[model samples]
Target: MMKVKEFMITDVVTVTKETSIKRLLEILVTNKIGGVPVVDAENKLQGMITDGDVIRYLQPKGRTVYDMFTLILVSEKEDLQHKLEYAIDHHVDKIMRKKEIFTVNPNDDLEAATSIFSKYRFKKIPVVDDSNKVSGVISRGDVIRYISTKLISDK
Candidate 1:
């Protein structure tokens, strides 16, 4: 009956809602992490932001013009630089997943994390305390590592 706190990463990287998209990108690259939890000044959970969200937000829209004769006229694709110039200044809250963030408590069983990961395919889940303060983070890799080192080896 292992607990999430046993395998979760206590040294979690986090960001504030007002953090700029540029800074977020830097954090991701520097940390080599796919996602992070968004927290308030008190370290309370706010939302989650991931590399996928940033990519989707920064992707440039493409435009196509068609003539009445069903012929494609001008097809213009917005350049990456064009979109990044404007998006870099935006805050993470604009693109962060703010709704229905699934979380697990530090005292919860490891099975809780497995359930969420299997059901939602989440890369990470924030581990919170009784007051909703972020305590740690559990990733799919963390679960697998724990199983390899602890569970399977014991069997």
Candidate 2:
């Protein structure tokens, strides 16, 4: 069976909670990557940051045009738009999602990889070593490409 490490990208670009949005955006645009693992100075996985995070930081707060869907507007002392704008000029810790981040070991099978991808619906999965340091990343696109080229295409 194919292993996660087999198709995982070894050279991963990572950022820290302290990484600014400008820098993060530069990385995403320059590398054309959807997401990057958020790590500490020691390279330990802190969280995951993505283009979604960036967009989350850009969303405006107000009533929107919902053709058929319901729009719930809650009264707030501070709105999301204000926070996002403040975050835009501030740090990543403010906007980056720090929830239950899923990780995979490099030696795990592709089945495990697929399961994680399916369950979490994440574009990229961080590959960690024995030390829990991000060794690489395995993206859904990579897995699909791998399966198509090596599994489906092979007799």
Candidate-wise lDDT, in order: 0.92, 0.83
* Stretches > 4 Å off in candidate 2: 63-85
What are the RMSDs of all candidates, in order? 3.4, 6.5
What's the TM-score of each model vs. the native?
0.88, 0.81
Give RMSD (Å) of candidate 2 vs. truth.
Answer: 6.5
- On the 0 to 100 scale, the lDDT of residue 58 in model 2 is 70
Model 2: pairs clashing at backbone N, Cα or C within 3 Å: none
lDDT of 1: 0.92
Q: Model 2's lDDT to the true fold?
A: 0.83
The sequence of per-residue lDDT tens digits that candidate 2 reaches over residues 38-145 is 899889898888999788667655544455677656434346646555665566776776787888898999888899889989999899988889999999999889
For candidate 2, report its TM-score. 0.81
Best by lDDT: 1
| Pairs of colliding residues, candidate 1 | none
